[model samples]
Structure formats: structure tokens, C-alpha cells
Target chain A: MAFSLDTVIYMDNNATTRIAPEVLDAMMPYLSDYYGNPSSMHTFGGQVGEAVTQARQSVADLLGADPGEIVFTSCGTESDSTAIFSALRTYPEKNHVVTTRVEHPAVKNLCDNLETLTGRKYHISRLPVAEDGTLDIERYKECLTDETAIVSVMWANNETGVLFPVEEMAKIAKERGILFHTDAVQAVGKIPINLKDSTIDMLSLSGHKLHAPKGIGVLYVRKGTPFVPFLNGGHQEKGRRGGTENVASIIGLGKACELAAAMMDEENTRVRALRDKLEKGLLSSVPKAILNGHPEKRLPNTANISFEYVEGEAILLMMNQHNICASSGSACTSGSLEPSHVLRAMGVPFTAAHGSIRFSLSVYNTEEEVDFILEKMPPIIARLRELSPFWEED
Target chain B: MWEYTDKVQEHFTNPKNVGEIKNASGTGNVGSIACGDALRLTIQVDENDIITDAKFKTFGCASAIASSSMLTEMLKGMKLEDAKNLTNDDIAQALGGLPKEKMHCSVMGREALEAAIADYTGVMLPMAQGEVVCECFGVTDLEIIRAIKENSLASVEEITNFTKAGGGCGKCEGRLAALLVESTDKQSSPATAQKKKKRMTALEKIKKIEEVIEREIKPTLKKDDGDIQLIDVDGDFVTVSLRGTCAGCYSSQTTLKEYVEKKLREQVLDTLIVEEDK
Candidate 1:
């Protein structure tokens, strides 16, 4: 129950992250002296708008898109809805949507809600994941049709950290002339993404997931894409989205993106090495521990493992005791006497699904932290297993 | 985050009386490994059906271990019949109180007690006909009723522990509870000595469940380098937890319900239910 500055090794960065110092430094001006509205009538505010334009240009440079294509939103979820809703409403004649069953709730739940919200006219075709948590390209191809208005898929999975071939999927949708959108919330920092090279029409990113503050996100709508505003209000975001900017958060997000680009190599190398240490240590020491995502093509800093026969909450509690914060697919969900849909979608058994634990790291994690986790986890697993009726006689 | 009590945390950190008893007059085990908890209870009974000594070894989270320890304490010096009549809620009450999700741990303790008593009596338990539900925990019908009858247990979670039914693949919880309600009526309108043999003793319940596992559940799981262990039994409900490679196996729940519970139902109680402990 005590709080400390004791380097509490946080491996659940996917849940959210501490704001980077550079991001804070970039946002400080906006919160204090430069607080005028970017849409104000005077030059003081107009200069602030110029800074915003420069920030937007930085974002555009990273994604290889034009500054005009980037529209700011509250978070990844809002961006997702905007892309999805824009596509659906722009082409009302086509009422079918092709999406993966493994999409984040921002897309999945919204699609689920459409049945009731739209009087059941919008048909959603949910593609299933393979045992490896990858989508079936052929099955995906089969699901698309002339009646399909939108093809939405996540660039990477939040739980398993499995990357999808959104580029290929978006290309297919392009060939079929269907609008394509991707929730890149989990991949914007860890993986390389170029909007200029791919036929991807829309993409979404959350600022908090990439070490900026929360309450700011981005939606990259490719030039010439059909657009509809989800939020209806003041003429901000060039009428693409409504309301004044989350100026401080948006400034922080831009700075975070700059930091991400500079750290991309370190993220892919140093952070991944720490991640591998955590992963390999758990696997070698803990017998029968199963990794959840594809071994080769996973996020550099995310590891999801299932310890046999133990409940997830118990494991998390023990980890919390050591101030080693992570997450479990079962421990962090809303009321539903079920494991995470992501794990279940991959056909993970209930026995191990209850035991699924996730450790998502960030640039802040170090080798000492990884080693500390390595030292702490096996005993925790063994201790929990001792209480578990499911573990074997050994 | 749940506001766990200090008592709950204390019991969790320092659970008492864990490990299997070597030899004893009666042994009661409850819940399943697949459901993430189970208890093996051993008791020594005097000629007068008085419980002289009791010990327990439990494999479960903090709640299960604490509840089992608390149950062992409660059972000491009590008549076997009195101990058998103890309810899961009573066991929970003894430990101050557990979180709602952890109520099943206390229920497991109570189920284990009834099972130990049944073993001591040498009763030829009947509960040999029921349906399989909860493909995750390997639960059946007769098991649920036996838990209710032996421990005077209430609620869906209690039935789960004593029976290993709803803890996994929760698809069968409602059906298991329905069977439990149905069988209370059936058991009330009873029969004779020969019919009483079908009443389901703790040992008999274990024996029947083991038979089903041997005949059906193990064969399928073994194909996947997995296995299950019979930990405890209360009345008709027999508790068997998962172990080995099976512990982390993804299809483990499917094996429990589709294979384990299904087999038990084919041989066990028609109106009984099987479920898992929390």
C-alpha cells in the first residue's frame, strides 16, 4: 500500500506510459504562455497556429503523408470511429463491412453496436484469426464484396502484439475500390509505417501509447478519401473534426513522434533485447509456459505468456507485491466471466487463458529491470502453481 | 482493482495446512486443477463417527488454501455428520469473509469435508447419471447435486468447486444449476437401501469420476501431452484438477467439458451438475 520511487519496473506500457521528458518540454509552452486559441482572430494566436502547422508537418513527415492528410482527435478510438463512420455514411448504398474478429474494441464494439444503431442494415463480416493470431488472406479476400463499404483491420494486436498485413489487406480493398482504415494505435512507435508507400486510406494512433500524454491522437486520411465528421461543432481540423485542439497534448504528441523516430533503432534493438531477455528467461525457466503471439513477428517490447493451471489475478497480485507491474488478459477486463477475446480468438484453452500474463515494455525499461523480472517471475509461477490444482505432480 | 481485505491478503500470503496426508481413515478432495483450485483433505474418525484429527493439502489460490485451512480447523473435534453438514458460506464466515469471486474457495473446503465423511461411511454412492456441461472444467450433473446435498452449499460457485463444473467455459453454469434444482426435488422423493446405494459417497464419487477420466477424459488430453488429477470428492461431485503440460494447454477447457464432463454424465447422475472451483 506504500508508494515509492523504487524504480517500479513497469512492463505494461501498452496500457499507457509515463510522459517522456522531451514530450513535457515540448508541451510546457502550450500549457503556459502560448495558451491562445489556434483559431483566434489575432496574430498572437495565428503564430500559435503556425507552430501547430509545423507540428502537423512533423507528423506528416514521419508517416510520409501531406500535412493536410493529418487530422487531430482525442484518441485512437475516436479516430477509428471517425474513419469507420465516414466510410459507412459516405457510401450508404454499400451496407456491408469486412473486418477481422480480432480488432480492438474501438472497431469491434462499434461494429457490434451498428447492428442496433443502424437498424441492422449494416452487415459486418468478421474474419477469424489463425492459431498464430494471423488473418487468412484468402478468407479475407473471399469476405470482401461490391457491397462492402469499408475494410477495417488493426495494424497490430494490442494483446498478442501480433502484426497484421494491413498493407496487403488495404491494397486488396483498394483493388476492390473499398475504403480502408487501420488502427495503428499499437504499432505507430514500434514498427515502421509509411502512408505514402501503401494504399492505406486511413490510419489511427493514440498519443499515450507512444509516450506522449493522453487525450490526443491522430487520424491520417489519405488525400482524396471520402470524409465525414464524427464530431459536429466549431470549424476546427479543417472541418474534418470539430472542437478546439487539445493544444498541450497535441504538442506533446508531435514531440513524442519526433522522439519515436529517433528511438526507432533503439526500440528495435535495445528495447527488443530487454524484451527478449524477459521472454527467453520466462520460457527457459518456466516449463510448459506458452508464448501467445508469433515468435518472429511480434512487437519488440511486448510479451504475453500463459503459466499452466494458475489463475491470472493471483499471479498479478504477486507481481504487484514486488512492484513489478504487468497485466493479465483476464485480470484487466470488464465483467465477463471470460478470458480476453484476443486469447480466445486464437483458441487459447480456458486452462491457460486464465493464466495469460502480459509484459509490454517501453524505452524506459532497462536490462536490470529485465533481470529483476527474470529473477522474480519463476518463483511466482511456481508459488502459484503450488496452489493450483492444475499443475502436474512435478 | 478489488479492495481486498488485510485478512484476505494475510490468509493468502500465509495459508495454513497445505500438503497431502499420508494415510487416514477418510480423505476428502474438492475442485479441479483446471478450475485453478482443489483440496485434498484427510481425517481420522473414531468409532463414534467423531472427527478426532483433520489435515489438508490444497492446490489453489489464496482463497482456496485459507478456506481449506479454516475448514480443517472447523472440522477438528466435530462429529463426522456435523462436519459433513457444514456449508460453504459457513466456511467463508470462519475466514471472516472472502471476496465474492473467492466464495468458491470456501465452497471447496465444505465439499472436501462432505467427501471425507462419505469416504469414512463406505456408502455406495449413486449419483452415476448426469449431463456434462462447462467444457472448460469437466463438470457433470450428479456432482453439483452431491455438493449441494453434502455441504448444504448454495450458489453457482459452490457447485462449481465441489463438482468442477462452471469454472471453465462458463457455457454450462445455468444448465448445471438447473440440474441441481431439479435433483433436489428428485432426491427428496427418495427410495430404499438399494436406492440409497445410488446416493453417492465421497469415495464412490471419486471412483466414478476417475473411471470416467480413465475411460474418456485422459485419452483425449493425453493425445495433447496433458493429464488431470483427482484431488477431492463431495457426495456425487468428484473434483479432479488438471496438471503437467495440460496446465497451460489452450484446449484444456474443451477437454474438461466436452471430454471429462461428458463422460461423467454418461455414467453419473441424470439431474446432477458438474462445475469448477474459482
Candidate 2:
């Protein structure tokens, strides 16, 4: 069946979210009539600069941070790179960095290529996760030492939606005098975060994952954190980053953050309930279906489920037939010939890893959409299982 | 999204002959759950060695399912001897061509068919006897060589796309490259011998060059609104002029050297030097 935009059910918010109507409304004027450069000497541009300042304030309010600490970059990847590189440059003597095995490739690939990128060999300790996709705090603490320049860990796993105790990990890094950064791209708006009360030196958040447009992200650096610019150019972003402000997206992100803050309760209650309903319904209806992450410690809006004996891409394509959008950690879907690193790090069995699907809900997802998935998903799994050679009916 | 063809989508949505054959003549199972795709093919053959029935169960992506469905459909009402000659390209063509990355699905279909044939005939497969090259996918050197020969694969990346070799961890890329060079050299030894003798007459050389240009090069260049014209041939050096959008273009020299020269070398003679007639 041909899919229409109106009927498309988007449950891949962890991948990216739909731009909220309010956010778009806030950004339209900036995109059209308010085309003045934010850094211009004229009043017309000064007004745009004021709007940028107000947007920065809104983003800061959402994160419980000061406006000065928010450094906007192109995307979450840039924010993550800026934070980690700033720490490494600040402590040139340190030759060790600590992160997790399940980090999004933004941090994972950066760490993996550090030696080749900088021509300096740095020891990296990737903390392993338990089978439930939860990290051992003690193991993370043991990996940290005086040689460690920065400890970068994700606040939540993108593939599994498994939450990590970044707050506690950051506090531990603080006691040891090591800079700590968290890639909170998946966690920021889905859950409550108050960086003002935390010891985290840096946190990264992307706009698109939280109802804003793509190409806008924020790196929250604490007031006293020493930093270096990743992109060295004209003085913008207070010399912490150097690029012309993506003005419209920044405004959109600010509006989105405000909306995310206001809808946090709805996200946790209604959206979470919908996610639970879809997850529970699929698990009950589909035989051999199992949840991929910790039941209680994951994101409220994300559900990772594995239907054994069926490949994830096949399941996703079948779901795509119904115009139900989601993502998969399967090797075939990722084009990597391996399942998700997060699931691999957690030691998910190959039988399940090859078939993992992630459905991440947003405020826009309706109960009716959840019901539609519950009805469509089971039969899809059954159909794929019937095609799967490994499947054996019990 | 893998950009599946309409045929692939059709077969995936409503696959034909998707079940285990009861009391089958032979059942072949290749791949594993760990590899992210597996296929179990069962065929029923008559006393006359005709495949009366064929069915498949595949655990993979849409391409794999589509390839399997297409394979089963192609197999029914075919002589077992003729079915043994069926290749992955035939399956891919039947499905209106799979995505390049998903070519291994068709290869898997072909392997399953071969295994099923071997099972029916009570003969051990020779391809399975080669030393394992890609540990991740359990692809062997013999299988890789066969795929390289059959598909005319030139690069490690193409080999990976076709056979899933060097697709994981990439530890065997060097080995894959060595095997590729070895296979191509073995296939081109006779051509190399001909080049060494400088055996081709000037008339023959011109004819071969024009044939290659007409059959191979012109269609490729025309895709980009470009054309090539053969100007002169002197011993081993062939001169050509680029016309249309390709004429005097910034990268026309690159096109002449990297593409035109390379294609002429591969098809006509390896020692043939191609120069742009500026």
C-alpha cells in the first residue's frame, strides 16, 4: 500500500522527531523576514541577536543551566567532539580517556580514532555494560585514574534506551579531578535534567531528537570548565565554537525545548503508556518476543524488543507496509554486517540481536497510533517467523 | 531503506511457496542466525530428475526473502541438471535487480540451490572444501574465487557486496584482495600471453578497440551526455577524442585516463596505452 504523509505513524523519535508546529511557527519569521545576521552592527540584526539570546535563555532554562554555558553547534556530534577535545587539549599530560562500550558512534568512533586523528596514542578504557544494558558504576570508577583527561559516557543508550547513571559517574569523575561529559541526546527532554545541581562538566543535546529542526545542538559546559574551540574561526559562541549561528534552527530548538519542558509530564505519562501498551501487546501476542533493555531503567518513551528467529529488517519492512515507522538494531538494517554495538556489548544472543526493533515515542504519538501498531506488529512478526528457517513452533 | 525493486517488494509482501516440503527429496540449509540471514530450501524431484516442487524459508532482510521466493519460483518445473546451472545473477535479474549491498542475498539463494542439488545427487560440494577466508561469514577462498569469476568482481568491496567476504571486522580484506588478484590473473593469463606476443594486427586492434568503444564505453559516457570518438591507433597506443559535454571538461583528462584507458586495457589488451587526442 502506498503511504500518505498524514497516515504515517512515526515512532522513531530516538532517530529524529517531527518539528513541533509551535517550534515551526516560532522559526518561520526568523527564516523569512528576520534574515538579519545575529552578529550585525545594525539594530535590525541586533533584534535577531536579542531573539537568539532569548532562545539561548529558553534552552538554558530547560537544562537548568546558565545562558552563558550553552554553546550551540551544528549537531550533537559536534557538541560531543567539542567537549571531549576541549578536555584533551586542557590536560595535554593526560594520556587516558574513559567511556562506555555502548556509546553512540559520535563518541565511540572519535575515541577509536584518537591516535590516528591526533598522532598521539591515548589509552582508552571502554566500560562494559551488563546483560540488561546497565553499566556497573564500580567498574566505571575503577577505569578512571589520574591519567584520564575526560570521562565521556552517554546518559542513555540510543539503540536500547537503557539509562546510565551519568549523574553519579560525573560526580565520581569530579572527586578524581577528571572532566566528565555526557551525550544526553536521547535523555535530555525525555526525562528531567538539572545540570545546575550536578557535577557534570559537559553535556550534549541535539535539537532534532526533541522536536526541533536538525543541525542545531547544544553543549552545556559548566561555568568553571576550561574549554578549547573545535572549529577555530571568527569569534562566535563566545570563542568556544566558531561559526555563524544557525539562527532559525537555534530559535526553533529553543521553542522546542520550551515545549519539551511543558510536555515532560505528558511524555512520561501518556507517551510512556502508549509505548508500554505497544511493547506489552507485541510481547504477549508474538511468541519468543523479548525486551532488549532494562524494564525499569530505560527511557520512558523507548521500547526495544526482539522477535527471535526473524530478521529485524524484514520485520521493519513489513511494518513499513502499514506506514508504521521505527528503527532496528539488526546488522542488515545498519549495513554493518553486525548488530548494534550496544546490544553486542550487553551480550545479547545472536538469535535476538539479529531481530531487535526499537520504537521510540514522542508527544505527537497518539493512543490510536499505539493501538494501530499493537494490531499490526504481531502479525508481522508471525509472518516473518513463518518465513524464518530457524523458527520452530512450540 | 534499501531501495528494493517493485518485484522485490511484491515477492516480500506476498511470497510464493513459503513452507517446508513434506517428505522432500532433499533439504539444504545454509547460513545461520548469527550471520543475520539463513535459508532452508526443500525441493521435490520426480523420477525423471525434474524439480516438481520447491519451497523456501528464509530468515533475513526483504531482499533475502524476495530472492528466496524468486528462486523457488524459478526452480519449479525445471530440469535438475538445468537448475544446477542457475546463478545468483539470474535470481537478481528475475527480481529486477537487488541493491548492490544486498547482492549477497541472491548469492545465498544460489548457494542454497546448489546445496539442495548436492543433497539430492548425493555428491559433496567442492566449494565448501576451500580454506575459510572471511571468518565472520564463513565464506571460503574457493567460493570467493568462484564468485569473483562468475560475477567478474574486481575489488574487495564488490566481493563483500556479492559474497559477504570482508564485510565484518574487515580482517580478511588483504586476503580478499590477494584472492581477487589471483583469480583475475588466472582468468586473464591467456589475454596476457596474447599481449606479450604483440600478436594483434593493426586492423584487428582497431576492430577490437572500436568494438569495446561501441559495446562498453559509449553507453557509459552517454549516460552523462558525453561521447567518445576513436581518432587514431598507433601500435599499442590508441588515441581518442571526447565530444559533447565531455569535450574540454575540467575532468575530461581524468575520464580519458582513469575510465577510458582502464576499460580499453581490460577488454582489448592490457598493454594498450590510451591517450586523449588533444
Candidate 3:
């Protein structure tokens, strides 16, 4: 692990992160000698059940919710689907949903596929965003109506890191008696979220995004909200979600949540400073490099920069030579010929959209790594510009 | 992440002939800034009709640049006629292979080569004169058809991969799907020779009727000191109104029943009926 870390500079934390050491240490026993089924009527299984309860409490504490409100699932996608389908099934009469135009595919695709899933047509109001990738609350409020069943929005955009006013949106949605759900997969660990005071009906978060192992996720459903089971099997998760508990990953996620709560300050301060420095250095050194997303209202860890007249895949390949890792919003990288939906929805021009790069930092990132990226990026952009047909000498 | 080949990586990193050949015999430019990938290829031909030198300046992703570079390398010292016959698959094969999604990069190279050849010979390629299918990218039906024929593309998605025809807005997917069937049907066995004409769903009929009225009818009417508006469509019946000079014209009914219905039937559906809204 030490040797691997020395050679690689990973900045694509929003995509996925390396599991934290503490999370792994806490999960090792579950993966080894403590592999008892939590549901068995035996002392060994009883001990495992106790550990599972403790893990649920840890996750609940991180979100400032009651432990009973938490339902463990397979992944963020599953959690999102569960929360959304539950609301749809509970209010079968309602045929409308409100969501943002720029959503992670988890919520966006599910909303898009609602008609096919339920065998009934749905009217979906997709709220558009501004040029800065931020939504207008007025437009959102206008979309909510009496026929609306649920309002699903992302807390932070995966590509742009633009934060939405989900709390305020949820409040507005609640007044209309509509269930509000936020896919906070990218926001939970990076920012402070106190669901206890919020009007949000349901929240979904994935473990891998927050430095826990993959295949673990949490859906926080406020008590007394109308609910339906997405997965039906032997009573598990209070019959809210069914499947045997993913013991090791559940333990890891609990530890990861605890660590996230403890390190929230460092993530906001040091990581935010490093991200700003990286952004400033690249903007100053590289000509025609503009930042994507809202400048002030964004996640601290993410910096999406677009270097015009140069393709993102070429820039990423060039960066690969220096052992630097990042992600792109370019269509070429996504196996499609258009840039990310978020960038396109924000009206990012073709040149910039084709060349946008997303650098997502984490608590593990260091200032030295930031400096190394700042040093290596300018020449990469310059070299790509030299080959670009649109580049001018000025 | 795309699992690009070593040769693709090599050419992407150390691309060959990365400049313009000024005063060249022929130059072919394809794509645009709005299209996300553009190529400007210049070639110099000798008296023997041999390409003596070739160079390109590209604005696209890694595969696009590599395809341009590979096309130039393949064009150098080659006969003009042979270069004209060079396929996009050849360009991809020369660089081991490109990702399936990036095949359009190679197609762009082939297009630029054809455009350059046309520039030299002063002959417009048949595809260049064909009807534009995708207005977002200015991709023509002949171009999409040729790519579909050459690549044996089976779906709209594959056509997008090869020629970028339906990659934008996606208003042309139904058209592309029809074209895909048309091209593939020609290659099928006699047992499956019965051509299946696409039946438009109700939603599709409404969209197509509106599009025809807006795109084909309204503009022409407005040009003749007249205007037209589509009121609604219920099944085969189309309700419209002629405004401006047409509202009081003596031949307005004849224009509606004959010209308007004829154009709508030809462009959208054959069973359409025209009735002016009273």
C-alpha cells in the first residue's frame, strides 16, 4: 500500500475513494472469525446482531437521525430506487414527479424510467439550471403541484460539485404534502448534514463515495412517512429493504461515518484550501481554462476546469504519464460523443464541454500532491493547445 | 478507462505530421467547433497524382488526433486514387483498433480525405450532395448510409459510433433507425425480403405532423404573402388555417386540399387529410 501510494496521485475521489485504514481495521473481524448471520437464533448470531445495531447507530449519528430510520441497502443506486419507488407505490394516485435537469444517473434514469417501471405514464418536471449549474428555487416551486408524488434532487452534482438547496427545496415540497428525497451520495461526507431538523423525507448515501467499502449504502426514511418495501423477502430491515446484511461492508461503513464526522473540519479547511490553490494555479498558468459550476456554492473537494481548444481525453492521457489521476466530463471518456449531461444542461459551450476535467479531492490528499498537479498541468495544457486546430498564438 | 490499444496510445502521444501543408493541391475540412471534433487535412500531390506530403490540424479527442496522424502517415507517397478508396476501418486497423465509440474519429479522417480529394479533382462527392439527416452535425443521409454499409452498423447507437449521426439532440434517431433497417434489409436473404415499413405511433404522428407544418408548410406559406398555422391533428385528419393574404384568397380551399395535403402526405404520412379550421 505504501509503495502504491508513493507512485500514484489520486484525485478522483468523487468517483470512488480508497477505503480508510480505520474502516478496514474495524471490519477485519467481521470478514474473518465473526462471520455469524445476524438473524440466526444463536449466541454468535446475537453478538453479530448487536454489532449491526451499533453500526446502524453510528451511521444514524453521522446524519443526525434516529437509528430506526436507517435502512441498509446494497448501494446508492439501490437506496435511491427504494426511496423513490416507495413514495410512488404509496401514492399510486399521484402521477407527477419534480427533479432537476442535472442529476446523477441514479435518480435521473430512475425518474426517466418511471413510466416503464410502473406501466403508467408519469409527468416529470425537470427543473433547469443556470449557466453556473445552480437551480432557481422559484422554478422548482413552480413545478411542484397537487398531482406531484415526490421531489427527488441531488444534494451535490457529481460532475460539477454544485450544491443544491435541497433543505429549502424539501421544506417547500413538504408544505405541498409531497415526499422529498435527496440523493446525498456526494454530499454526506464532504459537508455537514443534520437531517434531524430538515424536512427531507428520505436521504440516500453510498459507502464507497465516503471512504467505506463498496456495496454498502444507507437510506434515511423519516419516521411515520408512508412507506412500501422495494425488495420483498424474509423480514429484514423492518421489511423496508430485504436481503441478508452485508456484514463486513456495514461495519466498514459505520467506521467510515465515524471518521467522516471526526474529520469534517479537516476536509472543509485543508482540503478546501488545497482545492482552491490547485484551481488558482491552473487558471493563472493555463490560458483559456475556465472553471465549471458555481464558484462559491460548490463542494469544497471538487474543482471542474475546462481547458478550451484541447480535448479532455488527451489531457487525461498526458496527465497519466506523471502518475496523476483525474476524471473528465468529455463525451469521449463516457463512450458517447457528447459531454456530460450536467455540463451540457448548464450551457457550457461545445469547446469547453469537450475538454472539461473534474478533480475531486479527499481527506487523504496532501498539499504536496496539489503542488505536484499544479506544476504538471500547465505544460500539459500548453502541449495539447499546440496541437489543437483552434489554438491561437495570442 | 476506455482500454485503448498500445498503438493508439503511441500515436496519441507522439503523433506524426502535426502541421499544415501550405499551398497544397487539395484541402478537405470536416466537423466544426460546435460538433466537438473537427479536422483540417492538407495534402500535396505531385504531377504523377501521388500524394507527396500530407498533414493535419485537429480539434478533437485523443482518438481523433491519432486518426488524423495515422491518416497522414498512410497517405504519404500513396496514389491519389488509392487514398480515395481508404476506409475508416483501415485507419482504425492501422492503429491496432480504436474503442467502438471512437470509430467516428476514423470516419472523420476518411471524410476529410474524400473532401481533400474532391478539392483536387473539382468533383463533389455524391454524399456531399445528399440530404442532410442530422442538422446538429450536418451529417448527410448518404454519409450515414455509406458508414452503415461499410461498418455493417446494426443500430442507431452503432451509427452514432461510426458517423456521429444521432449523437446530438436525438431528433434523428427514428430516421436513423429507418435508415438502418433500409441498409440492412438489402443484405438479408430472400426469406426475409419483405420490407417492413415503420408504423408511427400516435405520439410520433403528432410530433411528425407538427414538424412538417412548422418546417415545410409555414415557411413556404409565409414567403407567398401568406401564413399557416396547425390547429391540431386527430388520427389522419389535420386541421389548419391559412392566414395573411391566404385568408381571403379565392384559391385558398384548393391550396389547402391540393398543395398543403400533397406536401404533408409526401413528407409525413400518405393517409393525411387537410381541413381548414372554420
> What is chain B's TM-score across the candidates, in the order shown?
0.55, 0.67, 0.69
Task: Report backbone clashes per prediction.
Answer: 46, 0, 0
TM-score for model 3?
0.87
CAPRI category for model 1: incorrect
**lDDT order of candidates, top first:** 2, 3, 1
Please give the CA lDDT of all the candidate structures.
Answer: 0.77, 0.90, 0.88
What interface Cα RMSD is found for model 1? 8.9
Over 4 Å off, model 1 = A331-335, B24-65, B76-78, B119-278
- Lowest lDDT sum, 10 consecutive residues, model 3 chain A, at A1-10
DockQ-wise, the better of 1 and 2 is 2
Distance from true location, Cα of A70 in model 1, Å: 1.8
lDDT of 1 at A209: 96
- lDDT by residue for model 3 (B92-130), tens: 999999988889999999999999999999999877876
Cα lDDT over the full model 2: 0.90
lDDT tens per residue, model 1, A1-394: 8646465888889999989999999999988999899999998898788878888987787788899999999999999999998998899878678887788999999997885766744656777788789888997886776778999999989999999999999999999999999999999988877889999999999999999998999999999999989998989999999999988888888888888888999999999999888999999999879999898778888899998777777788888888998888762232344568898889988677778899999999989999988999899888867655456666
Indicate the residue-level lDDT of A234 in model 3. Answer: 70
